[model samples]
Target: MVGARTLAHLAATAFLTVAGVVATPTTTHADESSDPDAVSAALWLATEVDDNGGIPGMVGTPDWGLTIDALIALEATGADAETAQEITAALKSHVRDYNSYDAWGVPGQRIAGATAKLLYAAVITDSDAEAFGSYDLRQETLDLVAGPELGLEEGRVKDKVDAPSVDSSNTFGQSLAVLGLSRSGGVPQSIVDFLIDQQCSVGGFRLYPYAFGGGTVTGDCDEQGADAVLDPDSTSMAVQALYAAAEHDSAGALEAADKGAAWLASIQREDGSFGGSGPTEASNTNSTGLAGQALRAAGETAAADRAAAWVLDHQLTSANAAAASAELGAIAYNGESLAAAQTDGIALFQRDQWRRATPQALLALADVSLGEIGLVDVDPGPVDPQPTPSTPGPGAGGPNGQLPATGAPVLPLAALGIGAAGAGLILLRLSRKESTS
Candidate 1:
């Protein structure tokens, strides 16, 4: 007769115990003098950006979404003004009519998630969201939510512009829409309600409401089916949105955020990592970063610290520099994929995965919470005339600027022994791995 939440927490504890993960101190006390991981990761991201200021994708093309993620990381880590200026200028050049596309020449309707991410970045960087590169990012994001074709009946944000028939947008997009809209000005009550309704009874969130079989009814969340897989990534993002909205006096926002944070804490592996319920079922940096930030935003400091420690332990630091070579500071998606990429010379699939993982991991290392990033008040002003070195002061790391090792034990994913879910969950494939918020 155990409740679902209790069952989940018990399962997590059992998984951790079986995996031999020894819990570390959840309290983090590092300062600028002691922590260089954040700065090093920021510098690594700066190097990844091309001359044009966009982060290179798997195919070596400019990806605005990835660039935005990197920018957020840079801001979180307090990167040099010149570095921020160069990247923001580059991001500004790519602004389109209504939204910023993921990459140029990709021919598809504007992605609501991408637009929402850009708006959030703009606000944090103090750029004019209402007038960035001749486009009003704030207005455009609002339009995407208000448009009859893109917005669902009860204020849900649709995934794509062309797919008018599909009413329910993915939870990632919905969470971003809520965060962006709330930060830009004020989020509508209906929009907030729609996102809240997406939470499942188990306290987790499904990536999408509609069943994946393609014959399900439009805009439904009451019934659970094959498509209703509880995803850690979506749940984390939803927690972030609810926390941000709660700051604006939104009713039930804080309560919902607490529920989502509890779910994340309950599901965390002994190694302090998280995995999605779909394609990304293995513990990886991307899910950990998202969940960590959400936990911090919700004031779940113990869970947040554990998640951050896991990310730091897995990063390519001086301890692992010999193994990583030139890839130092780049956070791998997972140890298995990193090994494969090292043996196979960075395949196309691994390119975007690393690109997305590094910045997210950096955010955790920097101890930057989602609520803090959204509330950045720095005005986007002229770039600093002089650029400073990426290296931190003495007591920080060594010449290569590697982070000081925390001596935390590295745990493998296999130890958990929580094999993938049934085919019904795996076959849905609705949740594809992508760059994060």
Candidate 2:
């Protein structure tokens, strides 16, 4: 006879398979007429917002960084008007002036990266960045560039000014600065030069120039140590910045972009995904998405498509319906991690992992390059009149709901004979554990 545990396992598996298949679209065509992947991913993102418009992170409060990520993804997928308006409304409340230490709960005495990302989001959504929430995003970004304390020599943008000895900004921040400034008019040549200086010998960009332990600063264009990692995320953002600057006829930016693209192509794994170094050393969806966008921007179509395919393969689709639960629209970080999460339950770590991974993956699925995300001109005609809620509406909630804690069984025990039930459970557990471990 089939044990109770075996029956339960079979029931959960059957339910998940049916639900996932029903929820996941079968088509692979990516045109405006039919983009199932993008649409499903975007809908999943909408459920992640908290009651205060923040994404759940940093002690359960709203995180501006994650918020910007979702905004970009939603915009890329052409998400519903209601969802878009709700997110923008929440984002508007988080805006702060140039003097504030905190903007959208991202704590830094000076907010360069957060402000720059907001500026990018504002531009792409066709909102008046200059007049967004009483703070002019364009002017604020320019302030970061021109501010004597925040702006370093040779056009380097710092995260904060009080700690001059500390290197507050990394390649990611610098890249965003370049991208934001490029859109406002043009990035200064000196700033462009400073960004180019961050590239390592391998053509990949390091997340930070300083070593972690003693925080020893490395020389420009030099790798810090054996531990000094070349990150795909930083490299991807750098490529986008360089590509944008090159459009302005910046002399060395194009060459730098070409080298970065070549470096990315060289490092791609046999499975078509890209991995990171240092802290983020795993091959996952976020890194792949960033690299894919960079590759696309550099006109590396074949490599970009390969990376995109890898991302699509990792998504919770109907093909894997029988194995996964009701996470139909969500994209897993990677196959291994997804299996682990499924078996052990989706913990805080796994939830945040998907939160970061899903939006980034959406970029690749939507075929939108990072450079094109905020750089392109979008005309969102005629704003719809939304009803003002006296109290917080459904937009305000924790990252609960939508995502299932466990794959509840949805089939009858009688359907799966005793022997079949026992075998299936054993196989499922073994396969899932093997992939994760």
Give RMSD (Å) of candidate 1 vs. truth.
13.5
lDDT per residue as tens, model 2, 40-142: 7766777787777656642465545566677777776666546667767776776652223332233444445556666676766768877777778777766
**Cα lDDT of all candidates, in order?**
0.57, 0.56
Off by over 4 Å in 2: 1-35, 97-108, 146-153, 161-167, 214-219, 223-228, 321-324, 344-349, 374-437
Model 2 accuracy (lDDT, Cα): 0.56
Alpha-carbon deviation at 241 in model 1, angstroms: 1.2
Residue pairs clashing in model 1 are none
Model 2: which ten-residue window has the lowest total lDDT? Answer: 428-437
lDDT of 1 by residue, 1-437 (tens): 01222233333442211121112112122233213666666777787788877776534656555677788777776665577778788767776421322233323445455566667767667688787776677776666654334344456654343322222335666677776666666676667777777777678877665655452434545565446668787788788777766655556777777898888999988877776654467677777887887777666778878877777755555444454556666766666545554456445555656666787766556555565563443332333322222221111111111111111001121012111110011111111233342
TM-score between model 2 and native = 0.71
After superposition on all CA atoms, what RMSD does each candidate show versus the true structure?
13.5, 18.8
Best by TM-score: 1
